[model samples]
Target: MNRVIKDTGSKYPIIQAPMGWIARSQLASAVCEAGGMGIIETSSGEIDNCKKEIQIMSELTDKPFGVNLPLLFLKDDSMVKFCVEAGVRFVTTSAGDPTKYIKVLKDAGITVYHAVPSLEGSIKAANAGVDGLVVEGTEGGGFKSPVEVGLLVLIQSIKQNLDLPIIAAGGIVDGAGMAAVFAAGAEGIQMGTRFVSSA
Candidate 1:
């Protein structure tokens, strides 16, 4: 079995990007129902509303889903505690050091993937003990690294250095794009722009 499928528990090796307020239950549930992993976003820092969204996801789709923790945007660890207590099985952390909450989330039995923009970041995340890496390239929308490495190059470079399951995120939209990433050595794909239109 694909490690991405084993890690995410989604039928497809696809994850809907957790885009701020837009990545709420309504959008996430649809993705889940379509057999892709849907992720609720805490990046918006609307903690209470995001929690409500997570609950709504349970009622909306029984399919496996996830939540993203944008460490730079988070004001506290309350959301982490919430996910742990709520029994969220999967999570992706970005915008800060992966080492900070890795132990707690892992100890809770959560499968954690950290988003990284460069080879150095990917290596650091792997060393920090993340289960996988969401390798976001320069083409990806929203926040990005100062270094502008493209998706294919980033995925290939990281794959050569670290033997970790990678969920490539960037300009991928259709099957052709997915195939391109897979050929570049990524095990899965994460789509944000396409899903924004989906929502």
Candidate 2:
């Protein structure tokens, strides 16, 4: 079985990828109730809000949910410790080199997944021992590669290069998009814009 689904308990093999200000407790909880893993974003380093959001989510579903911590944006591990203490088992790191913190996360018994925008980033995260990878492309909204590589093209470029479970992101808005990426070798899909727009 794919570790993504095993760890997340997402029935649809999909993740409601954290979208900074947009993916707060309301939208995230809705996705979790819908059978997909919802993620709370901590890009602002707002640990208190994250705590409140996680609390609300816990009230909505028993399924495993996740927290997204963009390592590049935070100054310390205070939030990480909060997640650990809060019993958050799954975390996704993006926008920074996660190597220095991977051990901390893993040692805390958390499953770490890194969101990467290129093959180089993917390999680094894989070597950093992130349990999985959210391989996003330029087509996705928010911070991304200016290289303009399409999602499938980026997936194909790095899929065979790494041993980690790959969760394809960007350019996925519907079932057809999901099926196409799976055929392209992704173990799961993470969609942001589609979910945010719907909310």
**What's every prediction's RMSD, in angstroms?**
0.6, 1.3
* Candidate 2's TM-score: 0.95
lDDT by residue for model 2 over 56-164, one digit each (tens)? 7788778788999888887788887888888888899998999978888899899998988888888888888889889898889888767677889888888779778
Which whole-number lDDT from 0 to 100 does residue 10 have in model 2? Answer: 82
Worst 10 residues of 2 by lDDT: 42-51
Off by over 4 Å in 2: none
Per-model TM values vs. the true structure: 0.99, 0.95
The superposed Cα distance between candidate 1 and the true structure at residue 58, in angstroms, equals 0.9
lDDT of 1 by residue, 14-118 (tens): 999999999999999999999999999999889999999998888999999999999899898999999999999999999999899999999999999999999
Q: What lDDT does candidate 1 reach at residue 18?
A: 93
TM-score quality measure for candidate 1 = 0.99
Q: How far in Å is the alpha carbon of 70 misplaced in model 2?
A: 0.4
